[model samples]
Target: MSETSSSVLTRMGAAFGSMPPALWRLLLVLAVFLVGGIAGWIGRGVLAGPADVPTMSVYEDWHLLCPALKTKDGACEISQDVYEQRAGERLARIILAKEKDKSMVMYVTVPLQVLLEPGIGLKLGNDQVRVYQYKTCTEEGCLAVIPVDDQLLASLTKAQDAGIDVAQPNGKAAELPFSMKGYADAYGAFLNNEAKRKSWWRRLWS
Candidate 1:
């Protein structure tokens, strides 16, 4: 053994370079890829939170029966005109079912003051002679925001004389503080908000 030369060491090292010997290297490469993929997947899951919905903003200058859009980052530019002529008429259904906030419902309440001068039949919580519109648009017939009170509905006729577009649609929609919901659902949202504001837990601890 003492006489053995260092040349034998080089030969021994070379012998280990066969195909089967490369098996360990291949296994290492596979393990690296698998681990990397799993890590990337986990990182993505952590980054995307519950409230995040991918959407672009919109810009809207003119509007009629549609909500205004602001400048946004998307392929399609949503306009007020397009929204009114053709948009998802299923607003109420979409809101009640999908809106994440359990405490409040969004409503677009058009005020009578904007169009009419005085003496309305229906009244809103704050304004008199009120009309709450439902977002019920159908192919044949669309639901108009009707004044709760019939007499107030009649009084709105005065707006017509003023040269204002004031034939109150039974379903009224206003940009100023406007939203759509079924009656029950709308009320429920209000209740939820009140409950949160006066939460029992907050009262007890505070």
Candidate 2:
């Protein structure tokens, strides 16, 4: 080739070499992320939807869900207020279904999950899904409080020597208590308690 053509080609090569390596790496990273996101969407079949999933009320650790204070974008502040209000000095959670039939009010005292497991054993109903873990506290003693993947099922399974009247679910979340109407009536004969009204502040927190 002629001298001028050789020099022009050399200048073009020099310009390409002078370009920042970081820019190339950044473009490569962007391409990889786009590919990964596409793959995940295809695998999960999640298309153009809200990514944020709300937690269930039954997972009773209110502290983590509580929002930050004195800052922008703090959603948990409302949750914090509500929990502080509903929560009692002593709290107990009831695992039960609400039904129109008075005889169907099947319920159990939610124990710590750590106490539930396999051959360890618990006498809950077959159709009974973990509906709730009601928190209860008295002046002297309290039930163990834990987060997700931990609840009454754990504790009950370990200690076969438990005293709760274990009953099987009657194939429905609501009807599971149908057979035990009279039994439930006679069991807790003492705590015929009246519901108390909560204050405005409690309502706000709640």
Candidate 3:
């Protein structure tokens, strides 16, 4: 070998000789791993194009469906003050339809495009959740019968805001906010109307 090559080899040999046998073996293994990784990375880059990365989205003031009796500009017009004023006064029940001889049931309407099988997710405030199955669907939308059970009524009384988790076919889900400002008052008034009030049923016949 040439003098320069021989000198480089001699220096390397001396350095390795000074290193512990275990350390030398470890370093050799590490060097091999690094070389293999680099080779694999280069090979992958040569074989494939850059990957498609998903983009994030940020929307400003997305319009939601109004849950109040009144709405303006796709938003609920009734504030907490208004809700308090008309809470019990506006409590009126409309019997959707009576089964052949079955009792009338209360119902809540939902928007179209909702998956009917899994039912709807109802979250009262930060906690207290329940799922109500769809009763039936019309051209307007689907209906969910709200049971006036003790727990549900109690939850509404303490809840400031409620959520309806709408299921989508694409696996992406969405939540709709429903203000429970005067829900308890209205529901209480409805409960007082025993003559009009009917047993809660899972399905609507009409």
Candidate 4:
């Protein structure tokens, strides 16, 4: 047979034009299947890939409440100035919270890779608190519960940020920043709550 050649599109169009209706339908169906298979493969590859890490926030769960925000009817209006971030897959968190006795406590939870002997160091402005002993450690991480006195509390409230310092076994140091966004307000609220609880207990017993 003599060879007959043309441009790719023209040759394809001619072949398709000369093809029987049934054969043309079969080719169309095969083309659709091929395209669909390629699309599905791409989708699966995208879905199975590693997910993107999220951006972490500095102030995570910092809130303040004070009696000054209370109304005249003996009901204190609570402010919802909350700043909190989810640790999720992240390593460490420095938490400042209040106890039942109105005392402030600082707790640091770090990854299991950290050394627990020297304790966790904390610094607020010019003041520094030495390594608070490690309380416990688990698969998640280690915990250091530091005692915060009135003087330290005052410094923390006035300072913009605090630092959690850790000394590695190799004598190197790692520092993490703790945001002081809503410290004063939260401390005020904690004191008010403690006072209210004490007043109620005294009235019940007396």
Candidate 5:
């Protein structure tokens, strides 16, 4: 390997070495569902869309994404793309969506080269850290779906910064940071759009 590549790998090994065994075990258990691919199914359900072109609206750093052909049950989400600084390559995409039951979910998609055993880490604001297992892998990348409870939702709305951490196959750790500059406004618009759609559907059925 080139000197630069070798140097990067060395740093990764050192980082992983410093991690406690118990932490590794905890991450492993959290990621156990990866074997069954249940999260993959859920990812598909949440992200899949018809062939029609999608529409996008920007709210500062976040985007309001919706399907082109609108129906009563059309899907929409707030999203942002993270990029690698040096190479300017797209690193990951973060998505936030609300379920029919009003629960929130966040999907983090990273490169296919990610290490699945350790799953991934989510950092919100200063001290909160959440570890999530990989739900599935596709040609695009691997995905981790995080269920957002009320507390987590509040954190996201209030956090000024957020990041996703992943381990590389070579044992290197990478943190992909995404901005929360307009998350609250984007999410509010998402909720309003969802409510309008649901109300229209109910009126039709009624």
Candidate 6:
């Protein structure tokens, strides 16, 4: 392997070696549960009728998902899932969607073992960290719905990485990091799709 690749592997090995065994087990379980939930979600969409089937497109690490047949409230979004490298388990899922008022919203879902009091911390690149409270928790996981204003959106577009921080039930802090490598491209495409959808709807009504 190249020297750079070897160096990266060394660092990753060291990091994983330092992680606690209990944490690893917890992450593995969480990953399995989350994946199953996602599968069920997709299955339901598939069974919802041919007109309501879901479609997904990939842009680097980000995915743009939308319904086959658009409805008045059917808005598309870009999402990414962060995984534990060692066990190949999902650590968290992040989604960005646009609202009717032209505002953006970020939905972060993490394992249910997180402490809800501290909420969830979002750090984009080197900027200040923002905390969003847990809006709800279901069988899948806990979700934090954060409103993304113009400033936040700008940061996201230019950011190279994002870190999501949450506290475990035992009060230990855990961070789920994901690359922003394709965020700009994915979001741009998402905007274009939204515009086209809106235009189509307008024409239909007119």
| Leading candidate by lDDT | 6
lDDT of each: 0.34, 0.33, 0.52, 0.62, 0.84, 0.87
Model 2: lDDT equals: 0.33
* Worst 10 contiguous positions by lDDT, candidate 2: 189-198
Give TM-scores for every candidate, taking all chains together and pairing residue i with residue i.
Answer: 0.23, 0.21, 0.41, 0.50, 0.66, 0.68
The residue ranges of model 6 lying beyond 4 angstroms of the native Cα positions read 1-54, 68-70, 100-102, 200-206
TM-score-best of 2 and 5: 5
Q: Between 3 and 5, whose lDDT is larger? A: 5
Q: Residue-wise lDDT of candidate 3 within 80-120, one digit each (tens)?
A: 21111344332111122223334333355566777888887
Query: How do the residues 117-155 of candidate 1 rate in per-residue lDDT, one tens digit apiece?
Result: 321223223334343344443443333333223443233
Candidate 6 lDDT score relative to the true structure: 0.87
What RMSD does each model have against the real structure? 16.4, 19.2, 22.8, 20.8, 30.9, 29.3
Which candidate has the highest TM-score of all?
6
Instruction: Give the distance in Å from residue 11's predicted Cα in candidate 4 to where it truly belongs.
Output: 99
Candidate 3 deviant stretches above 4 angstroms: 1-106, 188-206
Please report how far candidate 6 places residue 90 from its true position, in Å: 1.2
Q: Which of candidates 2 and 4 reaches a greater TM-score?
A: 4
The candidate, 2 or 5, that scores higher on lDDT is 5
Candidate 2 per-residue C-alpha lDDT over 74-106 given as tens digits, one digit per residue, 9 for 90 to 100? 222101111113443222232332233322232
**Could you arrange the candidates by TM-score from highest to lowest?**
6, 5, 4, 3, 1, 2
